[model samples]
Target: MAKVEKVKKKIADIFDLPHDTVLGLPRVTLIGSHQLYIENHTGINLYEKNQIRVGVHKGEIQIDGEDLQLRTVYSDDIFIEGKIFNIFLKEQV
Candidate 1:
């Protein structure tokens, strides 16, 4: 890891804070098989009925589903609804 990130991890561990939250990483929450909530997202790269790509700190998030709809979107949070089947992360170039 980068020096800054290594230090950040150390700090988070020492303080007992959530590493992702303290280091400003994306937080994804899945509800059953139908909904998703993302926090600390930068923006959406692509949106479609079956897929979504969201920009995050060092990469992007990919969501695969059916009849996908953005239930809520904000500067740092997003809510998606559908028959969510898969979610993955992709490194940005």
Candidate 2:
């Protein structure tokens, strides 16, 4: 990690704060197989009925599913509804 990230991690550990909140990392939440919520997203890179790619701090989040629909989108978050099959992170190069 970088020096600043190391410091932020230390602060988060000391204060018992969520690492995602402290370090600007992505926070992903899922509800069953029908809904997904992502926080700290920078933007949406791709949107399709079967896939979605969301930009984050140092990478992107890829969601693969069926009948995917973006239910809501905000500056830093997104809500998706679908029959989700897979989710993964792709680091930037």
Candidate 3:
């Protein structure tokens, strides 16, 4: 991490803050393979019935499942509903 980021992370750790909230990292929530919520996403890269790709700060999120559908999308968050099977994070090169 950069110096500023390291300092910010140290501060966050010292203060017991959530890393995702303090470091602008993505937060993904899955519920019983039927619902998904992603926070701090940059945008949706791909959307299909079986897969979805979401852009984040330093990487992308890939979701694989059946009957995938986006329930809601906002500037920084997304909600999905379907039978989720797998989720992956791919770092940018």
Candidate 4:
């Protein structure tokens, strides 16, 4: 891990803060099987009717679905609605 990551981990552990929240990692939430919320995201990598990829601090988040729509976007959060079929985390390698 990089020195900054190590420091962030230590700080997160000591303060009982969620690593994702403290270290600017991505936090993904699913609502039923049709919606998603992502926080602390960097930007959208890809957008399509069937898939969406979002960049984050150390990796990316991908959502597979049908009829995907970017419902809302904000500085720190994104909402997507569709027939969400799968979600996965991809690390930088």
What C-alpha lDDT do the candidate models reach, one value each?
Answer: 0.93, 0.96, 0.94, 0.93
- Model 2, global lDDT: 0.96
Worst 10 residues of 2 by lDDT: 1-10
How far off is residue 15 in model 1, in Å?
A: 1.1
The alpha-carbon root-mean-square deviation between model 2 and the true structure, to one decimal in Å, is 1.0
Q: Against the correct fold, how does model 1 do in TM-score?
A: 0.92
What's the CA RMSD of model 3 in angstroms? 1.0
Name the candidate that leads on lDDT. 2
Give candidate 3 misplaced runs (Cα > 4 Å): none
Choose 1 or 3, whichever is better by TM-score: 3
In order of appearance, the predictions have TM-scores of 0.92, 0.93, 0.93, 0.94
- Candidate 2 clashes: the total is 0
How far residue 7's Cα lies from its native spot in candidate 1, in Å, is 1.2
lDDT string for model 1 (1-93, tens) is 689998999999999999768898999999899989999999999999999999999999999999999999999899999999889999866
lDDT string for model 2 (31-61, tens) is 9999999999999999999999999999999
Clashing residue pairs found in predicted model 1: none
Candidate 4: pairs in clash: none
Clashes of each: 0, 0, 0, 0
Better of 1 and 4 by TM-score: 4
Q: In model 1, what lDDT does residue 74 have?
A: 95
lDDT of candidate 3 over 9-70, digit per residue (tens): 99999999998898999999999999999999999899999999999979999999999999
